[model samples]
Target: TFHSFSLILSVGDIGYYDDAGQFYIVERMKDSFKCMGRQVLPTDIEAVLLSHADVAEAAVAGVPHDQYNEVAKAFVVLKPASQNKAIRATENDLQDFVAGI
Candidate 1:
């Protein structure tokens, strides 16, 4: 009888090696959610939110949506310096920013 041996390690993450033998950890399974039938990685949205000049911090989560089943909602913390700016950012402003991307 011939048998193959496989070993597994509990690293608490999922990753893959690219064609170039580069290892990349896409996202932690627990931190990912479904949005409109697509897998949405929180870090992806967080990265976009953090790209904004006024955004100091951002946390994204999946929220219930009647039509889409789930949608991304962002909680943004603005920079202290931006608070004193003459022009304040509005919801539409943030929406437009993300839409542009």
Candidate 2:
């Protein structure tokens, strides 16, 4: 048995192509928002936020802004390891952590 290539249909999927000409699916159209004229995907930021050692759980949303129309606002849950620890994650620390990347 074999399969044949046919028509392609888009169902709110978002992706990009690299220099190698390979396509990569990154997110869904519904999951993305406009920020500073650029598409911002909450999942992308959530992935970055979850990379932090102190982030036990993370969720990001687009919040209204004066200049940018919208911006990412993350609601994060700190890991138990951060409780009473010297290296606890703070708002500024988390912001800086993402910014540094």
What are the lDDT scores of the predictions, listed in order?
Answer: 0.68, 0.74
List where candidate 2 sits over 4 angstroms from the true fold.
1-29, 82-84
The digit string of per-residue lDDT tens for model 1 on 12-86 reads 345566656554444444676677788988788889878988888776666677788767777687877653686
lDDT of 1: 0.68
Model 2 scores worst on lDDT over the 10 consecutive residues at 1-10
**Candidate 2 local lDDT, 1-101, one digit each (tens):** 11232222143444566656554444444777789999988888989899998899886767778899788888788987644677778999999998887
The local lDDT score (0 to 100) that residue 65 gets in candidate 2 is: 85
Clash totals, every prediction: 0, 0
Collision pairs in model 2: none
The total number of steric clashes, by the backbone 3 Å criterion, in model 1 comes to 0
lDDT of 1 at 84: 60
